[model samples]
Target: MNENDKQPDGSGGPGGNPWMKSLLVWVCILLGLALFVTVLGGPSATATGNTVPYSTFLDKVNEGTVKDVTISREQIAGTLSSGEKFRTVPIADPTLVPTLREKGVTIAAQPAEGGSIWVALLYQSLPLLLFLGIAFFVIRQMQKNSGSGAMGFGKSRAKMLTQKEGRVTFADVAGIDEAREELEEIVDFLKDPTKFARLGGKIPKGALLVGSPGTGKTLLARAIAGEAGVPFFTISGSDFVEMFVGVGASRVRDMFEQAKKSAPCIVFIDEIDAVGRHRGAGLGNGNDEREQTLNQLLVEMDGFDANEGIIIIAATNRPDVLDPALLRPGRFDRRVTVPLPDIEGRLKILEVHMKKVPVAPDVDARTIARGTPGMAGADLANLVNEAALMAARLGKRLVSMAQFELAKDRVIMGTEWKSLVMTDDEKRMTAYHEAGHAVVRVHTPASDPIHKATIIPRGGALGMVVSMPERDNYSYHRDKMFADLATVMGGRVAEELIFGHEKVSSGASGDIKQATKLARAMVTQWGMSEKLGMLMYEEQQGETFLGYSQTQRHNISNETALAIDSEIRALVDGGYDKAKQVLSDNIEHLHRVAKALLEFETLTGDEIKRLVAGEDIDRDAPGAAATTVPVSGTSIPKTRRPKGPFGSPAPQGA
Candidate 1:
C-alpha cells in the first residue's frame, strides 16, 4: 500500500494479519484429521462388480490404501455400514484394495461425489465471522469518539477564525471617527509591548467598546488584531455557559489557555452582558451558570498582567445593565465610546464606501450626509449599497443623484405605495399641510433654517419639511426649544386653518411624540419649566460613566408628577397658540408660499426667504443683527438668518 493508505499514527495497519499468521497450523490439523478418518475405516479402491464381504474390507482398510471405490452396505458389512455410497479416493497407497467396512461397519454400492462438506463450511464461515468481528470493533471506537453520541446537548457556539481568512483593519471601518482614534492606540500597545514596559507603563488589561447596536464595536476589535498582526480568538459571552455545572468555568479556562499559548493575541467576547449581567438579578434558576462564567472571567483578567501581551476586548450596547465588578478600573481599564456620527462624519463614511461604486458627479456625499441625521456607519453603508442597486435596476451606467434620492426615500420610508391611489383633493391637502410647516418655519425667527419642503409622501408621511441647523448646536436654549415645538405643531395647525377642521390623519404621530417628549423633558428633566423650579426630576447619565453608580433620583409624590404634566401641556399649548396666530396674520403670504410649495416640491432656505419677502413684511430694524450660537467643532461661517420685510429682526429665538 502507498503512504496515503497508512494510518495517521503510523501503525503497521489493522490486526487482521494476526489471524492470517495462524493459517498454517489450522491447515495442517485439517489434513491430519482427514488422514485419520481414512485409516480407521476405509473403502476398496476398485469399483466392485460384486459386493465385498464386511470382514474382508476391514482387513484391507488396516493397510490404509484406498483409491476410488464404491460399495453396497449388504456387500460390505464388517468394516463400515453405508446406505448411501461414497467414492473413495486415494488415501496413501493405490495398490491396496481397502476393505469396504471393518469394525462392525457395512457399505452399499452407489454413485458418488468426492469432497468433505465440513471443509467447505469452515472456509465460508471463517471469513464471515472475521468480517463481523471487524465491524463490531469499528462501532465501539465511533461510540467512544462521539462521547456516546451525546455531542448534540452541549456544543460550544463560538466561531473560529484562522490565518486563512484575513483579519479586519481600522481602515475597513468608516464614519466612526472618534471611536477609531480611541482604538488606534490599543493596536500600537499590542504590537510593541516593550515601548511601554521599558518605561514602567502598563498596557490596559481590558477595553470595553460600548455603543448602540451595529455601531461597529466588534469590527473595531477585529481591526485591533489585524493591525497588530496577531492571532485572534472570538467567542460570545454566551458561549462560555453550558447545561452542566462547571462547564462554563472550564470553557473560560480553556479560552484563556489558548490565548496564552498564542501570546500577543486578542480575545474578543461580544455581547458580554449576556453572562456579565448583575448577579442574582434573573428570575428563577437565576443565572447561576452565567455567574460562574463571570467569576472565572474575573479571575482570568486578574491573573494576566500587561507583560503577557494578551489583551481582552468586549462589546455591549446595553451598558446600563452590566455588573459594576466587570467594568471596574482594574478589569476594563479603558472604555471606548462609539456614538452616532454627525454630518461631516457621515460624509467621510460615504466617501469610503463610495470608492468601489460607480457614482455620477452630481451625487453629493455631503448633501446625503446632512439628510441622514442620526444614521450609524452600518446604515450609511446600506444606503450606498441601496443606491447602487437602484441604479442597476434603471439600467444606468452609474448611480446618479436621482437614484440616491430614491434610495434615501426607500430607506427612510417604506417602498412607494404607488397603488394606494389618493384623490386630487387629498393630494392638495397634503401640499397645503406641508406648506404650512415651511411657511411658518421660514417666517418664524426661532426655527432653524429650512433646508427643503416636499409634499411627496415618504416614510408614511403625507409630506415632510426638512430643517437643518446652520451649524451644529450642543445646547438648546429655552427659546429654541419652544420654537422647535411651534414648527412641529405648524403642519397640523396649517391643516386645520385651510381644510376647516376636517378629519385629520395620524400622519403627525411621530412629530407629536417627539414634541411631547421634549416638552415633558423641559419641565421634568432639564428644569426648563419656570413653575416647577430648577430641580431635575429625570436623571441624565453620561454614556461612558454608566453602571458605576445608582443614578436614580429620589421619587417625588404623584401630586408633583401631575403638576409637572400640567406645566408641560400648558407650555406646548402656548407655543401652538403663538404659531397659529403667526400663520393666521400672514394668511396672504401663506397662500402664495403653499402654492409655490405645491408647484415645486422642494425649496431652499434662500428660495423660501425670497418667496416670503413678497414686498409685504418689514425687512429692517435696529438690533436686528442675527445672533450666532457657537456650534462647537465648527469653523464655517454661519448663514445669515431671515429677517422681516422692514429689516426688523425676525421673531427668531423668540
Candidate 2:
C-alpha cells in the first residue's frame, strides 16, 4: 500500500474505524435470523383470537357453548362450541375453573412454557445492549474528532509522504548554500550507505535547524528526502503534546517506530520548540505533557543508532529555549543555523523563484537583490509572487521591472493609501520633510543613496524617502551611525524649518522616536560616546530559558545613568543640528526639490541627485507627473518646478 494512503494501525483500518466491521456484523446477524426462520418454518401455528365481552364469555362457558379454553394470568382465551377462538379479560375468581367445569365445557389451562426464561432474559437485556451500543458509538465519534479513540491519545499525527507525493527536491530550494552542504551529506548517506560505512563513518542521528520564520528550514528537509528517494514523515511538535498526559510520549514512540520501518527516511518536526523548550522553566515544576513528550523524544533519539539510516530533522526559531539534553551529541548531533540570505544569496533565490514566472527581459534580479537587504529566502519568493500578481492585475503579459519595483516598495513600506486626501499645506510640508531626508542622505557621506522620495501616502506615513544601499553591509561604522541618526532627524527638522515649531504636524513623532532610540543605542550599546568609555551597559537582560529578551538589570550607578541620558540627548541634538545646517547651506536647492516634488509627487534617487547638483529637471510632457525613473534606468520627463508655494520658485538666480 502507498505510504500516504495508510494511517497507523490503531488509528485507522477495521480495528480503528469500525463502520465496515459493524456493517458486516449486522449482515451476519440478519443472515442468521433468515436461516433460523427457514429451518424452523416460521412461528408455529399461533392461535388467533377475537376479543369478546367478559360476561358473554362466561355465559358461553356456562351454556356449554365453549369447546376448549386456555387460561393465563390476566385473560381467558379459548375456542367456543362453534370452533371460533375468543378472548376476554375475566375477573380473578377462585370459582372460575369450577364453574367452567360444571357447565360441561371442555377447558384446558395454559401449560408451562418452554424456553420462556431465556426469552424473558433476552427481552430484558435488549434495551441495555442498545444503550451500550449508542454510548460506545458516541464515545468513538468523540475520540475520532479529538484525534484519539478510547485511551488512544498516543497516536502519531505525522503525515507520511509517498514517492509520488510532495516531490520537492534540491532544485526547488535555493540560497543558503552552507545549509545545503551540510544536508547533502545526509542525502548521500541515505542513497548509498555502503560508501560511508566502508570509511567507518556514521551519519548524524538527527540535525536541528535553527532560524527565524520563513527561512526555509522545513523546505530544506523535504529536499533532502527527495534527493535521497526516501519516504518523508512530517509532524509538528504540538502533535506530540496532546491534552491527555503521556500522550505526547506515546506519540513520540509511535513516530519513531514508523520511521524505523521506513529506513533511509527523513523525519521532520517543524516548530519543535513547542515541545522541546527548556523543561522546568515555565510556571511551577513543569512536569506536564510537553515535558513528558520531550523526555520520550530524548529517549527515542538515544535509542536510535546513527547507522540505522533513519535520520531525524527538526526546525525551531526558538532554539535558545530548547533543552540541552535534547541537543546533546547522541541526539541532535548537528546544529544548522539557517540565517537570512545575503545579497548574493537573495539574488540566487530570486532567480530560482522567477523560473516559473514569465519575467520581462528588463527585470534584473541582481538589482532587486541589492535594494532588498537582510531579506530571507521566503521573503524573496513572496516578493517574486507579489510582483507577478501586480503585473497580472495590470493585465500585462509578463511580470516587469515596474511591477517588481512597486512590489518591493509595497513589501517594504506596506500597501499605499491612495484614497487619503491631504490639504495643499500638508502636501507641501510632507514634500519638504521627505526632501530634507533626501538632502541629508545625498550630502551625508556615509548614508545610502536616496532611492525614491515621494509624497505618496503609504501605510501610516504621508511621505517616504527610500535609500538604496549600494551593497549588503555586514557592519556599521561610526560615520554610518552618525549619518543614519541625522537622516532620521532630518524629517522633523525640515518640518520645523518649513512650518514653525508651533505649526509642525505630529507626523514627525515617529521620526523623533526613531532618532532618540538610535542615539540611546549609540551611547549605551555601541559605547560611541566620547565621555563614556568603551563599555556595554545592559539596558535589558534577556532570559535564555524563557526565550524572551526583557529584564532590566542596572549595571551602572544612578550618577552614571544621568550621564548616559545626558550623552544620548547630546547625540540627538548634535545630529539634528548637523542636519539643519546642511539644509540651511542648501536652502535654495531644498526648495527646488520640494517644488519639483509638488509638481511630480515623486522623485527618483537620480533625479534627487541631479536636483541637488542644480541640474535642469523639467519634463515638457503632460502625463509625466505620477511616474519616476528606475534607479539605474533612463529618466522619464520631469515637469518644471511649480511656481506656486515652496517660496516662489527658489528665488530664481539668487
Candidate 3:
C-alpha cells in the first residue's frame, strides 16, 4: 500500500474484512451471556461466606453464635447469630449432624452445581476475545474507508449498466452522423458476429471515440450497446488508479477477468486520457502507478491472451496525449472522430430535443441551428431546456420563438445581467460601441451579416453586436479574417471617435484583447502575414506536470520573434484603420443605428438596416417591410426579414 492507503487513524474500515463482522457477532453473544449469568445466577451466589476450620465451626455452634446452616456434599456453610457468614469442610464423623441438632441450629442440604470450573474459565477469556474483536473491527473500518483493504484493493470498480427503460439506441442520437454510422457497424457486428467472421474479419478489438467534450461520444458508445442489446460495463479511467503502486494494475487485471467471463460485452471507459497519457512524456522517471495500469490495460486489450468477444469503446477529448501503444491497430482498431455538428446536424439535434418540449409554431429549428454554428448536441439540448424554462417563467403554455431567441441569447452570450445598472453616459457609449460594430460589419463586403446589436448588459459585456453566417463555414479565407479583425476593432474605434482617446473607458479592453489574439493567430498560426511567409513560428504547448512546462524550447531566433510581433501589430493596426475608415464613411448610419439601439436596447439585423435607411420600425408588425440600406457608396440589396422565431439572421461569427 502507498501513502494514499493510509488513514488518519491507521485502521481499516468495518466492511474491509469479512471475518470482522463475525467477530462482532461473537462479541455481542459473549456480552449477552455474561449479562445473563450475572443477572439470573447472581442472587443465589450473593451470600459469600468466609472459610473456617471444622473445629472453629464446632466452637461457633457450641457458643450458639451460628444462626442456620446449609450443607453440600463436600462443604458446610452457616450464618452466625451476628449475621456473619462462614463455610467449612465436613468431617468423616457421623456425630457432626447430631451435634448441630443439639445446638438447635437449622440445617439444609442441596446438590452441588456442575460446570462451575468451565464457566470460570470462559469468564477469564471473554475480555481477551472482546479486545481482539474490537481491534479487527477497527482495522476493517479503516480499510473500507481508504478503499484499499487487503482483499478489496484489487477489485475492479466497473459498473455494469442495466439501462432498461431509458436505454438509448442509435435512433435517439443525432448530429455527427459520421461517428454514428461508424458505431452502428460495431453494433451490427456485435449483434451478429458470424456476419463479419465469415468474411475473415474479427470484430475490431476496440473503437476509439475521439471528439470535443459534449459532442456525444459517450452517448454514441451507449447507443452501440443498446442497439446490440449486449452487456455494458462502464468505468472511468481514474477508477483503476490509486495512491497504491500496484492497485491500478491489479484492478485492470481484475476488470479484464470480469469482462472475459461476460464475453460479447462492451466496456466503455470515459476519459481514458486520465490513465492512457503518453508514457514517459511527463517529468520524473515516468514509471508511475498510472503507467503501470496503462501497461496492464494494453496487455489485456491485445496481449498473448486474446479477448475474443469483447469490444472496448473508450472516449476522450484529448486523444493527442494518449500513449501510442494503447492506440495501436490491434488495440484500438478504429479511431472515430466525432466533430462538432454542422448546420444540418444541428437542425436534426434541435428537432430531436424540441420533440420533448411543447414548442409553438413560431419556433423554426433551421434558423436556430443556423444561428448556433459551433454548438454541440448537449448545448442544443440545454438551449431547448432553457427555452422551455423561460416560457414557463413567462406563464406560457408552449415554448415560443421569442423564448427560444432569448434562450439562444442566454446560451451564447450568457444570462442577461438585468441587475447591472448603467448611467446614461455609459449606456449611450455602449450603444454607440455596438452600433459601430454593426455599421462596419454591414458595410464590409467580406464580413458576415449582422444578426443583432444590443446595449443591454449580458455576461461581461455592456453590449454586443452579434453576426450570423449565411451557412456553416468550415474554414476562413484571408479576406474574411481581415473583415473579422476590422469588425472587432469597431468597438474601440467608436469609443475613441465618440469620446476623445484620453476619455475612452476601459469598456473596450475585451475588444482590444480579442483583436490582439486574432491578429497574433493570423500572423503566427494562420500564416496570413506576407512578411512571415507562411512559416509557422508559435510552439504548441500541451499538458504539463504540476502546472510547470517540461521544456521551454524556443525554435525561433530573437529576430524572428520580433518579426512575428511586428507582423501582429501591423495586422491589428490595419484592422483598426479599416474599421475607422468604414465607421467614418458611414458616420450618419452609425449614429442612426446607435440612437435606435439606445431607444430599443436591442435591434435585429433587419431593424438595424431599416434604421440605417431612416425608416420608422413598426414594433407591432410581425414581418417588417424590406429596405435597401446604403453602405460605403453602395446600396445593400433589399432583403426581406426572415419569418418565424429568430427575427434576425443566424449568428455566424463570434
Candidate 3 displacement at residue 509 in angstroms: 1.2
TM-scores of the candidates are 0.69, 0.81, 0.80
Q: What tens digits encode model 3's per-residue C-alpha lDDT throughout 210-293?
A: 987789998898888888998999999999879989989998888888888898999999999999999999987885899999
Expressed as tens digits, the lDDT of each residue in 359-474 for candidate 2 is 99888899889877657887788889899998999899999888898887766556677677889988898888878887877788988777677887765567777666777665
List RMSD in Å for every model shown. 13.2, 7.9, 9.1
Instruction: List candidate 2 stretches off by more than 4 Å.
Output: 1-70, 77-87, 97-127, 139-152, 194-201, 303-307, 418-425, 539-554, 614-654
**How high is the CA lDDT of each candidate model?**
0.66, 0.75, 0.78
| TM-score ranking, best first | 2, 3, 1
lDDT of 1 by residue, 1-654 (tens): 887766554434755353443454455655665565554334433433434444444444565443224334323322223333333233343333333333223333553334334545555566675566566655655544323443422333444466557667878887787888888887888777788889998888889999977678888888887788788888888777676777788777767776788888888999998889888776777777788888988888885443276788999997878888888877899999987677777888889889989999878888777766556788778889998997898899999877776676566544555465667777777666666777778776877777566665544555666666654455668777777778767767777888777766555555565567668767877788888899978764544353232235559999888888899898789767877987898877678767765666544455566677883212234432121111111101111222211122122211
TM-score top scorer: 2
Better candidate by lDDT, 1 or 2: 2
| Winning model by lDDT | 3
Task: Give the worst 10-residue stretch by lDDT in candidate 3.
Answer: 629-638
